[model samples]
Target: MRADRLVSLVLLLRQRGQLTADVLARELEVSTRTVLRDIEALSAAGVPVYAERGRHGGFSLLPGFRTELTGLNHDEALALLTAGSGRGERVFGLGSALASAMRKVVDALPESHLTAANDAAQRFLFDPETDLLSRRLDVEEVPKETMVEVRQAVLAGHKLRLRYASRGQAPRRCVVDPIGLVTVRDKGYLLATEAGTDRTFRMSRVLEAYELPEPAQRPDNVDLERVWAERCAQFLSEGHIAVQVRVNPARRDQLLDMAEAVRAETPDADGWLRLEVTFQDLWHAEWAMWQLDTDAESLAPPELRSALHQRARAVADRYRDRP
Candidate 1:
């Protein structure tokens, strides 16, 4: 850990040119005394670190010295910059580290390619609070402490005890053998097992988390992508409501994209495309169909159609009575 911290200190100085002990302490999550000691240690080890004494004075390396640690090219630097813009870092509690690393990456770039790469990177944006259609992005709330504990357990292969509150269900205590953590659409989940049964728990729903001292009982080499895929398949299959819908051909692609497990059937005689899709439940189906407005019609599971009708009628009644 000290070795890593020392390396990070060198890289930080190399990236920023000059920084005060206070700034270094804050960035490295250590004390000013520790920063001073590390600075002395770096100098003793022939790192050429020097300190300037004044309000604006700080620690700096000899002029024209670079760390030679990161060798990112133009495109690679831009890719790292773009990834740093994502929300995953915030969920994983690496926001500050990512910011510091990005600064180093930008500073490490060749001057000739720096400005152009930075400008080109501005063309791509990610996870804007509001999308093009004026719909707000969904950002799940996960407690920082909870996320940190869960992440530590998953990475260290330790057992985790969590007080989970599933929707519409009372909070329950469970001990899990964590396999990995996954983030999808800005939401985080822990792919784990309880009593040898597979379970996926949303980080948002974790009311409390504690890492156990015992090592987790999990596969030696787990494939997180494969596990996530299997979990998704199971989630879509269990207690899911299949809805048959007829959509205008022009809007067929939109409907399919919005719905899960979509299967295209022959177009109806009226030239509308028929599709069968599965939704997590009735409310899930209703919400999805609601987004299509009038472009798609739900045709099956009479209850779903009735639910939509009632919702539309309720909206119409509200406006009808307003006048």
Candidate 2:
């Protein structure tokens, strides 16, 4: 290692009260002269490293010096790098910007920790996939400009004028006070407070949005986490399908991993696990059943089972019609 680089490493260890020139030289794979030069560089840069020469001697930092997030051990460095990658676009916002920040953090870590950090990255990957038999719950990416404005408005306690579209009606305009934003697997949504009542809006339903000039007067006691839970409960009550499935016990994890909102039930004597999953809609439930093939059976909610049967018959009917 270069003299300057070795010096930086020594200072990092010394800040943690683990400073020994001989140990730092071995750690850096360099000689004592290189280590000494590094100590000089640190002194030049105003990082205090006091050395005591004797049988019990090492090094220590100057008293009363504190730096936020410094002197990270190997595990701490690995954890920080791993957490940075998973934040992706929500906390960091999408694309190259988040990737650049992650790269900078990884670059700052010691060379010895690089392999562990790389392994951590490789172990976790983000991919969102839905089964073919399930109705595709399509989610649109909120424009980056809109996302930024929404975040700011929510933080600044401002109201927003939004153009919204429902499934069966033409787009309409309304003014709402921004509450918070929630990000599900691949989807993002906004929760807004209305003048008369509290309600949440999906960002995907927004056709257009503009920050209103009026002040946002929301209740000071507004609990965002509670609001999120309430909205989720409402979605499950009206927009969800209650699906019960009898699954082979060995295939439980595989099936649960494939579907969202799946709750495993007690296993029967036959070792088959029963499951109840909340589907976005009936079509989504039916599609998930199709993905499991014969390994699972949809029990409750006759409509879902019937839909699955009808879809299977249609495939057979197509071939029959060909003749």
Candidate 3:
């Protein structure tokens, strides 16, 4: 919820006129380092925030710059604030805008509820980088220049040229009529059409992108949710290799991360967990299972079991003698 934290930082400055980084950090429930970074982000976004160094000096906005948005109830403000932190500011290319809008939302609240609303919003966390077990979600990174180009084409209804890299494939050049962008679980996908056929490209794998001058050839109205659901359905119906596994409960998340789906689950007599999982193909299944090491054992699909056995033997043979 860095977005909402930024809003709170601005609100604190706006309320107190000027406050030192220590006070800002204390009030915002973050460190002084974080406060300084938020200040930089605000200034880069043209927020007119300025810092005065020395005793009795701190950060303040330029005179005559403030939002006049008001009349929002505490609950409404709370909802907006929660959304800001939940979706985060990185969606699409509007991180700055989201922070600015959330600031306005914070400012609109009655002074009595402003602090309470922000505190409440801070309670609900979503899609944080670290999970309960301290395992990190490897958030995908999309290049800024490439994302900007692809986002522009989608918004402007222009065709886009991309040096794209798909899974397990070499990067290649292609042009697609842009439809829209979709972000799920911190990963972004650019949904478009290549030669009148629907296509979805992971934004991270876009090595390079350029907004084309020509307009896109798209339907009159695009329902992104419907199109995405249909594509997901198509993928689900396609062939997948299903393998049953008994895995240590502790590494269950690691196993599920690489699986396409979980079809069944149960606990074994010895306290291990048994489950049926699907992978993209046999190779994928083998690779996924191998990553778990001894934490998982394949129970079905003779081909997968044989492949795992062969892989283990190959490794054993390589290290048959100590290095």
Candidate 4:
């Protein structure tokens, strides 16, 4: 870990030219005393580093000093660049560090590989602001202070006290042991436990967070993927509506795309597709069916069919008066 910190220290100086001991300490997540010790170690190892002694003095590297990094080929360099697309970085409070590391990675590549790799990587875009339909993507705003405290607690194995604001409920204070942080579809959630029960808290709903001094009450090793999957399955099982529908051939794929689960799919006698779909609730089913217009017909659920019929009649009545 110290080796990695030393390497990062060198990279920071190489990229930014000069930084004070306090700045270096904060960036490296170490104390100012530790930073000074690392500076001494670097100088002892023949690195061209020196400190200026004045009110505005700090640490600096000798002019034209650059450390050579290896182990990354042309494609690998480009892959690293493409992966750091700047989306989801702010959730964990690593936006600035990611940007700086990207710059260092680009600089470390060979001269022959730099231009070609950058050109190839520029052709790929990740998490664009707008979709193909020209609709703007929704990005949740989480307070930076809250995100930092939550992340620190998780990484340092400490307990957290959260002021959580659930929908239709007043803010409540709860103490939780943070198991991990999961990001789904550009949204962040804190997977934690309270009183030996698993719970998921959306980062957006966290009104305030405080890191407690006590260690987290959790197992040493956790399978985050399994936990997330179990939570998702439990969520889908409760408060969901199952609807059977016959969709026209042209819109069958669109209907499937809108559904969370497709229990069965078969071709009907009239060449239409019969799909057993699951939605979050009745409103979700109705909105999805409305998007399909006449291409979809609700077959089994009489209540859903009635609701759609009523909506159609109301629309027709309003238009008739206009004409």
lDDT of 3: 0.85
Residue-level lDDT of model 1, residues 31-143, one tens digit each, is 99999999988889999899899888999988776634346677886777778785646756666667766766765677656777778779988677775557676788888
Best by lDDT: 4
C-alpha lDDT of candidate 2 relative to the true structure: 0.69
Over 4 Å off, model 2: 1-73, 90-140, 167-169, 249-260, 320-323
Report the C-alpha displacement of residue 41, candidate 2, in angstroms. Answer: 28
Q: Give the Cα lDDT of each candidate.
A: 0.84, 0.69, 0.85, 0.86
Model 1: which ten-residue window has the lowest total lDDT? 64-73
lDDT of 2 by residue, 1-323 (tens): 36446444644563456567787776555687877777777778787667888887876777654433346676777666666654344541344345444544554555567667677667765443344445454446677767766777877878998888876799998889887777776567788877767667777777787877677877766777888888777766776777889998766766665565765577777888888877777777787778888889999899888888898898888888552
lDDT of 4: 0.86
| Shift of residue 112 alpha carbon in model 2, Å | 8.1
Q: Taking the candidates one at a time, how many backbone clashes does each contain?
A: 0, 3, 0, 0
Superposed on all Cα atoms, the candidates' RMSDs to the truth, in angstroms, are 3.7, 12.1, 7.2, 5.6
TM-score of each: 0.79, 0.61, 0.73, 0.75
Q: Which lDDT value does model 1 have at 70? A: 43
Per-residue error for 157 in candidate 3, Å, reads 1.8
Q: Candidate 3 lDDT, tens digit per residue, 118-167?
A: 78878888668787879787678887778889988888999999998888
